[model samples]
Target: MTVTFSLPPALEARTPAEPRDGVRLMVSRGTSVSHHRFTELPHLLDPGDLLVVNNSGTLPAALQTLDGVLVHVSTSQPDGSWLVELRDTDIARTGLRLRVPEGSLTLLRPFTSRLWVAAADVPGDRVSYLTRHGRAIRYSYTDRDWPIETYQNVYATVPGSAEMPSAGRPLTGAVLAALAGQGVLVAPITLHTGVASAEVDEPPYPEWFRIPPSTAGLISHVRASGGRVIAVGTTVVRALETGTGEGWTDLVISPDHPIRVVDGLLTGLHEPRASHLMMLTAVAGEDALRESYTEALREHYLWHEFGDVHLLLR
Candidate 1:
């Protein structure tokens, strides 16, 4: 989908999506479009459709250097270094030492245009260190700082994500109960999200993910029984497509890649140039994606992590 449009400031969801069920859900199947309240999600899916959710908790991973530059610790590398992004600053270079309240991180090399490999000298576990000294990462689209709880989904358990797996943000306890009563199934995947891409030119960094054996079996069973496998977020889509139990996934689900798992996606609206758009295209096709975004913009649907959601079903 090559369509693009201006994002007026009024349409950016600047705060938390509280009363998550109250948010709008735009459902798109092929070129057909419909709108409903997010609480109605249970009725949208058929019986036995499996909804795979990401349970990786959001981390307050944004810390400040001694010079006040923001460092977003994204993911930990296998070699014990961390992948991190330095926001709104240009002093980063190889061998650079970023000092924080807890410890210092020495930059090793460029992982991406905005991210660098850094060795952490913080005390205790990385999660605890970040918990004690860091705060939630926010982009310029947001109006003000919000608490970490606001970024987290109701079902998040494993703590690792630098940012929230926001597609599951609208899943309220009420909706979960309704889905269960409706005979829809739910499963879990752990994909710790890294920081989002701020530039269109940059691709996403590799993320750590784990797909439990039970969840994998459920996906196959549900599909064989004529049920759809619906991914709650792009994180779940990425994790499930890796075809492995646990590992770092570098898979970028563009139209070039085959959609091996998810038959539908429940996700938040993305920015104009966001790479997640490509993944949506892979699922819904280019024409459907093009038409859906055009309609979403015309209807004044909000965008961003705290915004309204888009359900792309095949």
Candidate 2:
């Protein structure tokens, strides 16, 4: 199905909501749609429901090469290397080596011709090297530079993701406490997201993920007790659906696929024709998904990482 809509430039949120939970939330239960503040999430859920969140923290993945060109570190390879996306120019080829003050970088292979697998000649761990030199990756849509903390969720713990699991951004401490007071269980799984691609309909690349035995057991128990397993983000859904204890996932959720684990999804308003729209369709069904988007657009809901949220319940 071809889903398209006009996302006005004014609707792109330049910064996060001041109270965080002040963001608008569009709730879609089957074909029914309702509006509420993100703070009302607890009231919308049943007592026995389980909310699964991604605890993987954001990483400062953007760094400059010797020539001052920007390179975004997308994913960390099993080896010490990293999958990187070179911006502006296209000189990043197989076996191309770049010299930097921190270390030398050797391009291994092209991840997508624009992105390449490259290794840095650092003495210490790659994470440490990046921590010392890198800055958080930002798109042109984001008006100004913000700290990495701005990209983090309230429950973020593990450090791995190149970008924030932004769907959970509106979940403040008060919201979490409210959900807990309502007897809703919360759990965490890790999925280190890579740099988001602008290429439409492209499948997600393989990324490291870990679903602990405790979280898995909780999911099974929730299912057995007839509780809805609400995924906080697409990253959480990807991790829980494909991960055991630890592994890499290339699972692509589409309309053709059946969602076996997640019963609901809390996500941001994705762009029209974006790959994420297909995943939303898998959870809410196409008609509901379309209606929700139309409502969001009509109501002038913000879009992107720092925008409003949509909760799709089945």
Candidate 3:
């Protein structure tokens, strides 16, 4: 099914919400839809529900060449090479190696096709190099560059994601405390997200993820007790549904697939025709997703990483 809509620039959020938890949330359950402040999420969920969050921390993935060209570090290969995208340079074909500034050399490869394999000559480690020189990846929708902290969720731990698992960004300490006080369970998994510029029809690339034994146990217990497992982001959904273990996953959740682990989703408001929309449709049903997106647009809800959220329940 083709789902398309025009996203006005005015509705794109340019900065993080003032209180983080001050963002708006649109909830969809079956045919019903409601709106509330993000802080009210604890009240919306039942006491026995389990909230699974992605704890993969965002990385400063943008690097600049001495010649003033920008390169985006998209993903890390298992062999220690990096998948990188050049901002403005053009390459005619694959199998070509180009020398970048700052002593880095990039080889055009077929992995992901759009990104080249990059290796830096001067680096203690990829993390160390990125920490010293890279900046957070931003798009034209963002008015200006913001600090990496602005993109991180309150529960971030394992530093790996190329981009923020943004659905959990509005979950502040106060909100988490409130949920815990009400007896809601929270679990953490890790899914290091790659760059987010996939073509509309392109499938997702493999990304590293780990579902800890503790988290896996909690999910099993929650399921046995009839508690809903609410995934805080698409990354968490991908990790849990794919299985409880550490590995690279290229699992794509779309309308053709049935989700087995995630009972609900709390995610950022995605634009129409986005790949994420396909995942949303799989969870919320196509008709419900359409209604929810229509309502979000009509209410002028924000979109993107620093935007409003949607809670879709079964």
- The TM-scores, one per candidate, come to 0.98, 0.96, 0.95
Full ranking by lDDT:
1, 2, 3
In model 1, which regions exceed 4 Å deviation? none
Model 2's alpha-carbon lDDT is 0.87
Candidate 1 local distance difference test against the native: 0.90
TM-score, candidate 1, is 0.98
lDDT of each: 0.90, 0.87, 0.85
Tens digit of per-residue lDDT, candidate 1, span 231-261: 9999999999888689989988899999988
lDDT, candidate 3, 121-211, per-residue tens: 6556666677778899998888899998988898999888888999999999999999999999999999999887733345678999999
| Selected candidate, larger lDDT, 2 vs 3 | 2
Q: Model 3, residue 208: what's the lDDT? A: 93
Clashes of each: 0, 0, 0
| Arranged by TM-score, best first | 1, 2, 3
